[model samples]
Target: MRLLIVDDQPLVRQGLRAVFAGLDDIIVAGEAAHGAEALELVRRTAPHVVLMDVNMPVMGGLEATRRICAAGRADPDRTLPKIVMLTMYDQDEHVFEALRAGASGFLIKDASPQQLADAVREVVDDGAMLSPSITRRLIREFVRRPALPAPDGELSALTGRERDVFRLLVQGYGNAGIAEKLTLGESTVKSHVQSLYRKLGVQDRVQVVIYAYENGLI
Candidate 1:
């Protein structure tokens, strides 16, 4: 997969490039020090995924992502490259705004190199990726909100088992942990996760957690 790296720090870019160096399936197509440069690079490289930093001079990643999505929408035949916000901030507002601006996921800088690679691969494969802390924040926010009318499309879509899986998921349980908790085999839990993903139109666990929060399911 062709990849673009967008960060204000040269060291961050270098570290990310070095991380991708070990992955044969990924290629670093371009690098940018700021959002404006990122926009230009996206236009030129047409990368499959962008690892974007949220804070930067001239333009922020959020606005850049918005613009990129807007441009892609203007050209219907072209699919926009997946945008992942890699940042130090895990605040509720930041995550929410980034998602609103079309970020496929958000991760912190402290994530291991393998985690970074996994996040890239997830987005490239049309999936979502959010750090564990972000997932927790989303769940807490969702649970704290006043109950609203649940959408029939979202509510009726989930089966009883799927709802159980989703509840544990929002609480930050992995498939194995969930399986153990539910007294089911790992493969059975995996099947339920896949079904939940399809029913919710979500690509990854993070989005599933976010959906639970947004819909007040957890």
Candidate 2:
């Protein structure tokens, strides 16, 4: 997996680069001190995933994420890069906004090297890296809010099995977990997941969670 590290601190960037150095499968594509440099590197290197710091000088990670995602949308031929925000707190206010800005997931700034590596792989594999604590916090926050009106017949478009898969996915179950829970094969669960993605017009698991929360389906 190719990765670009975006942070304002030199030590943080160096530390992350060292972590990935031990992994044979992952390559550190480049490093940037801020969001503007990140954008320039992104265009030049075309990394598969970007490890973005939430707060930075010149341009913030949120704005950079918005721009990167927007660029992908503007050019269908360009593959969208998955962004995982590095944050100071799981309950940080910017976490949700990062998701809204098109970030794939988040990791606490003090996450261990193993956790960092795992998060990178997860996001690249089309999974969201929301830990249990983060998931619970998201649920709690959404519970206090009023639900947005879902588009006409959006939920109805899903079949019974697809709905089951959707619920499990929003609950943070991966394909293998969903298969075990529903007593189906792993490949079958993946098929249902892709089907759900297609019907819901979502690109990844993070978007699925956002959709469920926004429509009051969770």
lDDT of 2 by residue, 123-148 (tens): 99888887667777887888998988
Worst ten-residue run, lDDT, model 1?
A: 201-210
Off by over 4 Å in 2: 131-133, 156-161, 179-192
Question: Where does candidate 1 clash, by residue pair?
Answer: none
- By TM-score, the best candidate is 2
Q: TM-scores, in order shown?
A: 0.72, 0.87
Per-residue lDDT over 135-193 for candidate 1, one digit per residue giving the tens place of the 0 to 100 score: 78865776678866657787688899888888888786877789999999989988998
